[model samples]
Target: MSDRTRNTPEMSQSAASRRVAKVGLDSLDNLWFQVGGTLCNLACEHCFISCSPQNDKFKMMSLAQIQPYLDEAVVLGVKEFYFTGGEPFLNDEIFDILEATLAIGPATVLTNGTIITNRRARELARLEANSIYSLEIRVSLDGFDEPSNDRLRGKGSFKLALNGITRLVEQGMLPILTAVQTWSEAEHERMLAGFKQLLADIGYTRPRFKIIPALDLGAYQQNKIGPAVTEYVTEEMLEDFDRSQLICSNSRMVTNSGVHVCPILIDYPDSRMGESLKATTGEYRLRHPACYTCYLSGAICSNFSSGGQSER
Candidate 1:
């Protein structure tokens, strides 16, 4: 057998099944809205989709572009919605867009946290009170301190992001702090503890934390050890593959390009479902390298209500 065949353990299975048992897209209670699409202000070293100011493979979904889907998603029993982008705040119609979304169900906005303004905080507060549904704001901070985080994110991002979090706390909205797992197991506790202390120092006594594993895609190609070999989903592998843990089993993301398996694989072609949400629900072959990370991380993207930290 060639080295390619040996390396691509699941390639044969993927190629064979490419014409059979195609993954069917299903709409679940949770629907992901690509409100910001592919635009983000701060380009991180390991962003799976390679979100940057210039990377507009998928453009921002405007309020008009998103409302019909929101209406459809609600009808299909979508209880929660997630909003992400290059930087969600960069969208000119963000508040208006969020107000429309908040009216339906719970909404979670994933942001880098530097651009959140005082006015935006007040708007979020208003939305929280006005809407029967809940609103969660997740701030992505790669590390606890500036020195560690700045290098991965960019210069002056750590302090500005902290300011955003502090403002959210003052607004009485407890935003979740999200970090990628880069530290050793022994170091994680210390980092989270320090984060808790730091949040407390900022007067946010109760702070929620999540550590996400890096998905080896986009800019992460530089970090790839080697191309991942996907094993065939045999009866033996089925024993270990927990169906409930995979994001695609429960949710699908709708971007300008179309529906995809999940938010993490928007940029990957194999993950694309179809032009509409209806075409995207079914079993995926689990071919991408990021699938391995998801298998290990399990439900790392969901929001947490309680103020506590969990390993990704």
Candidate 2:
């Protein structure tokens, strides 16, 4: 899932059937900004958020709308910040927003890597160069070649993404390439080899790869994808589980709508805690099937985590 899917029948179905597990905020270490909302250039089959060009359930957030959150994050002792969307680069004021964010702390923007022109890469490089904090650009390249990537993304997406990666590489920005896992664990070695070769084709030797898990949302929910979510997190599931590995245990995402529990659950109105960061310090119930992915995969949304990035 990407910046990610929303509203499904899991909650309503489980409401009366059973009690879902809940997680409390250990500490507000990470802050997420839904800068672009659900307005992505490409309508990827795997996006849980179901973000697309026409989907404007939530609108793009301006720097003015985010400044207060940035201020509040500092008060909340937020160690770092993350920027995600349908496609974060789709926003016009993205650079300005990053500039403002970098002034406070490190920031990472999750993008599909299709619209990252040479100019845009240079601007991002400048932002990273100017800041003492780290600026990570995570690009989602679903497959190694055009056929595979384009199948999940769109036609010609592989070429455009390669160009985007090339530009960023030329500017000395090594973006973390994220590919949702669509293959079996047995194919892991083969997939890694192919991905390496793909990066090599574009002169990105020693590329960092983060093979993310495909959550059962959006495309998966509609039977367009495999491994439907049949279970949810229960009290027994969290008995001895390390809650720190969960995003909701230490993160909150701010969208144009309001402050949500986490970036993954923003589509549900119940996920919206309140209008401010203070109101979000409470515990979050793990009702959605997406939580099962986090429970199984660890905090995939975070940069430094036990789960998420496979290597480098």
Candidate 3:
């Protein structure tokens, strides 16, 4: 493990036991499937999970493994489903999984967008069209142009992702373009406008967008030169705050390894609640440093943009 990851607040059992705030599971509203595991086709410099071609710390889940959870989620009255991974599209049964998920509830997939071909986009459109529930595809793009995005994602990634978005647009799908907040807050408006214009140029006029705050994990943690999270959440801090804003209050991530508290903390051992969703219930302590990020940024992993509302 990286020193930064090792130094996370979750690692200090004694300190965490004393200072952490407990968050109970309000309901099982959102179900996330870690379908692709830690295996992406392209390894982005700032990836939270350090997903790559060979990282197998978590293995890809098969359709057979996921079906049982889908059935259970239905019984639990799950309102929405989310698919994420090294890259969810990398999974061979991604379409099948999405099809099954959309049949039950609204579904969203978090993808890097490089693997979305014209054929694949058309198929995705068909799935969305057939489903009664909403189907949202969130594409990750670091920048509006080639140089800026390629710098973080890798060479030739910008062009490929742009092409994929274009195809999705052509297939009548409105995808949510997600970018990490790599620049200062002062530059947010300028960067957002640039992205809007870029998407408009490619026929994605009035594109939906979401900005994500960078987390200190994966490759970012390995480098350990960025701003470090210094604050830990306390019970006193939740006095006047809306606890509903926390993803853990409404969601749980199902992975091949086990059912995790949330999608962001799957790498942390303590985040693994149990082997099954039914087995994982009750409250979870905000012990990881990443919890501070979530505390500061309400449900950062959700489909909606934070827009300063995350900070209480």
Candidate 4:
């Protein structure tokens, strides 16, 4: 039997619950722009997309190509826009693209943080100063210190990311430092406290932080899949599951190829929605194990705003 069919009824239940948990795609008002696409500077050990400099599975979306969507999004009641990629800053036109995006609605960029140079910091400051909408940057850091961090991100990456955050603070922008949760309970608290201390020492006294669960995909496949006998989604959980909390239901990600259901399943062949955002709308099958992660986590990717639930 194939991996999908070999699972127990519990696994099928999990998958069904995921499908039911998805919000209506038509109700979606948030637009995610994949500016950097499938090209990232660093080849991290656990990147879900396996993004690297040469992985042009998806290409960059130019300012012109994305601008029309920004305008279209405003009409669709898209209150927020999200930018992500291999590394958004890798594109020379990233500032122009971000500036354009900020004009329509609040924008958030998920970045590795190692690429934020002094020039980019100045641009970020300018974007915040002139725009009526807000701009937030989420910097991904695996650990508070070098040894723990470099283990996942690579040598010298820890220091470089810290430098990027330090620059954001210096530019008068408060950035959210995101870490993946991979430590024991005691170690986890210690890690949080360490981050707090590090931020204070670095002059970002009120630094925001988000810790994420590592999804079993890409490089993580080598580590292991979900538990040996993990449960899938089922219809029963839909009784109380908040479909709006699930990103795939309402939010569609625009990639180089076209649109996809969500960011997590970009590399999945069947996850492709269509050739355009207008063509991609409706239900998505929660067939993959990763779907179960979203179902159980309840908004792991898009749940947070600066201080409140994401403006849906």
Off by over 4 Å in 2: 1-19, 305-312
For candidate 4, write residues 241-293 as lDDT tens digits. Answer: 66666677668888877778888878777788887667677777666667777
Query: How much is the lDDT of residue 264 in candidate 3?
Result: 91
**Once model 3 is optimally superposed onto the true structure by TM-score, how far is the C-alpha of residue 215 displaced, in angstroms?**
0.7
Rank by TM-score, highest first: 3, 2, 4, 1
lDDT of 1 at 93: 86
The total number of steric clashes, by the backbone 3 Å criterion, in model 2 comes to 4
- Whole-model lDDT per candidate: 0.74, 0.85, 0.85, 0.77
Candidate number achieving the greatest TM-score relative to the actual structure: 3
lDDT of 3 at 292: 82
RMSD of 1: 4.9
Query: What TM-score, computed on C-alpha atoms, does each candidate reach?
Result: 0.87, 0.92, 0.94, 0.88
- Off-target runs (Cα >4 Å) in candidate 3 are 1-5, 9-16, 305-312
> How does model 3 fare in lDDT?
0.85
Query: What is the C-alpha local distance difference test score of candidate 2?
Result: 0.85
What lDDT is obtained when candidate 1 is compared to the true structure?
A: 0.74
User: Candidate 4 — worst ten consecutive residues by lDDT sum?
Assistant: 1-10
Give the clash total for candidate 4.
11
| Candidate 4 Cα misplacement greater than 4 A, ranges | 1-23, 225-230, 306-312
